[model samples]
Target: MIWVHLLIVLAAIFLGARYGSIAIGAAGGLGVILLGATGAPVSREDIPFDVIGIIMSVIAAIAAMQAAGGMDWLVALTDRLLRKKPKRITLLAPIVTYLLTLFAGTGHTAFAALPVITEVAKENDIRPSRPLSIAVVASQMAITASPISAAVVFMASVVEPLGVGYLTLLAIAIPSTFLATVATSFLANMLGKPLSSDPVYLERKEQGLIELRGAHEYEERPGAKRSVLIFLIAIIAVVTYAALISENLNIISDPTLPRTEAIMSIMLAAAMAITVLCRIDPSEILGMQTFRSGMSACVCVLGVAWLGTTFVSTHMEAITAFAGSALTAYPWLLAVVLFFAAALLYSQAATTKALMPTAIALGASPIAAIAAFPAVSALFVLPTYPTLLAAVEMDDTGSTRVGRAIFNHPFMIPGIVNIALAVGLGFLFGSLML
Candidate 1:
């Protein structure tokens, strides 16, 4: 019966991948039904309502900002900065995308920067693949580092009771992941041939298919800067409140609002503030791309996390008996498992909510689990990720094309290096701090 139920779960994931988008989550719902039918005990509480709620609230605020032209304003700043030093784009592009995701708590922000990275790379005769690949990788990787990201927030909740506080987790994650991102950018710089010498680029140039469009022109929005400032202030408030309530500080002893609850309410409040202060239409937020993608992500987290938690909870004892000692003996193995599961789950938050508790329950060290948190950013193993695909399509130099072998694409090597290096750095920092 267990084997049969597992097969049903795998099949649902396969079907979801085929359907794409919100359907992937819908498929998880179907798997839940099948599991219950097969005699697996299922509970309503397994739905991860908090995780979904955090995603929704964060997305709402980001979407509100986007509707107020804040996203365009941010992208325009990055574009101007990149053009100033096109020769160093390979090194700087990932930093830009990473910062965007870190602030927005969603990698989808990378979409707006892809064209700018490509154009700047071409203008300087640099290979677009170099910057574009690392930029996409960095965007996704930054999720684990972002303070408001569902993955990190959920992870903080998981480890807080085990003697790790929110600030400690952030202290380790932010620096380790940022340094790894910088290191990977340097490595990605040398991966492919120079844009001028690449056969495919040369062919495209000769055929008049390649266009060297200069820097993108973004119309300045009157409220763009104001919206960005409002959003940044909100983020600071979230972090500050979390710190005050943290176990280490205990400034807000026995506070009525928990950190998770604070994040959700603060973000929703921020959304309302942005809407009112920026004079953004509430209806416009519903139509914003950030809102749409974020809602879809909410659905995905709902279904997939529900299904995963149900299975793990039902079979916790057997799972612990089988793998607990192995994990305890090799703590770093947890990072390896997260790295692969993230590739399959396609969501760092979903993967973390699904697996991190099991690791904690199995007696894996808190520091080890926190260190392994960055491994969930391994969304790049599959080229089908939206940011990865967008990078490929945006590069006109033909330097970022995916090979016939799907995993043999531009994102694979740099992404793997980024995750691997981040994990190593996590352990290094985890040791020093914890």
Candidate 2:
């Protein structure tokens, strides 16, 4: 069954939606059947409903932001900033991604920022892949550092029984993740020189894919500045509130108070207030297609979470038993093993939930596990991630392909090295056992 799960995830990575869905669905079906036959406590009632709610609310908020053209506006803003200097653009791209992911608690926010990062890279004659790589890597790094991210929240929950403080784990993770990002960017730039002169670059340049066009239509709308400001304020308020609640800072801790509910309430209120204040019609804000798209995202998230939960529950005893023995025999193998495991799974959240508890049971440090989070999370850099696919489609230059030409393209090699550097630094920072 474990092997079946692994194969399904790998097949998903290779064949994408059509095959990936079949593979995952089949594996999940088999797991359920086997569990039922064995009389395992694999009831669907055990599914993580809170996780489903979080996913749906997040999708809704992102959809709303997209409909409001905030994403497009952000791209234009990045273009304006990066048009001045390649060096500054190079430095700022990852920094901006890190900040966004820290606040938003979703890599999708960083992924949304990619088009802007790519645009800036184009404007400066820098490879769009360069900034895109940085954006993705930085986003993964932020998951470990962010107190509000799913990985952090999940880790906090799992490690609580191990006598680990969430803040203490976070303090260790932040420095390690930050160092890893810097090292990754530096190493990637060094190895990716040949990619700059690749034929795809020349072709993209000729096709004007690298050129900035007339002002984006969204930027010229009436009261755009005010709307943007309001949106930013709303985002800031949400982050501040999340932090306050997570830390229990001077606020009564309501054990029943759901974080997702709080987040959704804040986002909805902000979105409504900003729309009315800017005199934007609700219909216009939602657009014609936003609802369906948002619903699709919600469904996907829910299905994936349910599938992951089902898989975990069915295999819980076997996985825990194996992890206990394995860790006792080979402690240092945990980091590398988990890295490739997550790469195969293509989902840090799923991998963390499935494996982190087992690792904690085997006496892994919460701080060490937290530090290792980024390394496992970075595994999604494989061309399999939907956002990476979107970026590739948008470019259409084959520049983002994993290994069509040389292994050292801006997107390919840098992403690989980024993961390696992150893992290496995790060990160096005492985040992982060597």
Candidate 3:
């Protein structure tokens, strides 16, 4: 019966993978019905409404920021920083992209910087794949580090009972992911033949396909500066409030609200403030790219997380009995599981919400679980993700591309190295926090 339940879960994962993106969530709910038919009905307890609310609210604020041209303002600042040191873009590009996504709490922010990284690499005669690959990976890896990311929020809820605080998670995640990104840049720089000597690149050049497009002259929209500042202030407010109310601080004398509710309120307020103060049409936010991706993320988290919870909740006791001692002895194996789960799910937040609960329930320590958090960034294993596809598209040099094998894309090696190192660094840093 457990095996049958597991098979149902696998089939749902397969169907979600086939359906792609937000469809996974829909496929997940169907899987639940299948689970019920197989004599395992998911109760209301299996659903994760809190996680969904947090994702939607965060996305709303992000969408409002995009509609307000705050994202454009940040991109413009990134462009200036990159041009100041074209020679070091191999290292610098990932830093820029990493910080953008880290602060923005979503990898979509990397899109603004991908074009800039590719162009700089091209101007310096560096292979666009180097910076482009690591930059995209960096953007994603930063999500695990971001205090406001849905993945981190989910992780905090899972591990708080295990004695981990939000700030501790951030402290370990930030340095660990940053060091991994830096190491990935070195590996990325060595990938493929030199740009000038690469035959495919030369062929593309002969076809007059690769052009050294100059820097873009960005004209700021009205209130762009003010909007970005307001958004930043909102972020600072969120972080500060979280810090004060954290278990370590205990600054809240009388607390009636869960952190999830607080986060939702703060973000929704930020979105509304951006809409009103920026004087942008509230309707415009719904049309922004960030809004669409965010909504997709919300749906993805809803379905996949609910499905995952159902499967795990049904089988958790058997799993705990079977793998408990082994996992308790070798908790790092949990990170391996997280990496592959995220690879299949293609969503950090969904993957986190779905799997972390079972692991924590099974006795994975807060330290081990938090250390493994970086592995949730494994969306790069498949090239189908938006950032990976965007990196491929933005590169005009033909240097950045997917291989004959579906997973043989340029991001594969660097992304793999990045996740592996991040997990290792996470363990290292996590030891101190523990």
Q: Which candidate should be chosen as best, given lDDT against the real structure?
A: 1
Clashes of each: 0, 0, 1
Best-to-worst TM-score order: 1, 3, 2
Query: lDDT, candidate 2, residue 201?
Result: 72
> Per-residue lDDT of 11-117 in model 1, one digit per residue for the tens?
88778877778988999999999999888998998888888988999999999999999999888899999999888898899999999999988998898899899
- Give the runs in model 3 whose Cα sits over 4 Å from its true position: none
Residue-level lDDT of model 3, residues 238-273, one tens digit each, is: 788888888889898566766778888988998998
**Model 1: residues >4 Å from true position, as ranges?**
none
Cα lDDT over the full model 1? 0.90
TM-score for each of the candidates: 0.98, 0.77, 0.96
Q: What's the true lDDT of residue 392 in model 1?
A: 89
Candidate 1 local lDDT, residue 349: 95
Clashes of 1: 0
lDDT score of residue 248 within candidate 3: 87
Better of 1 and 3 by lDDT: 1
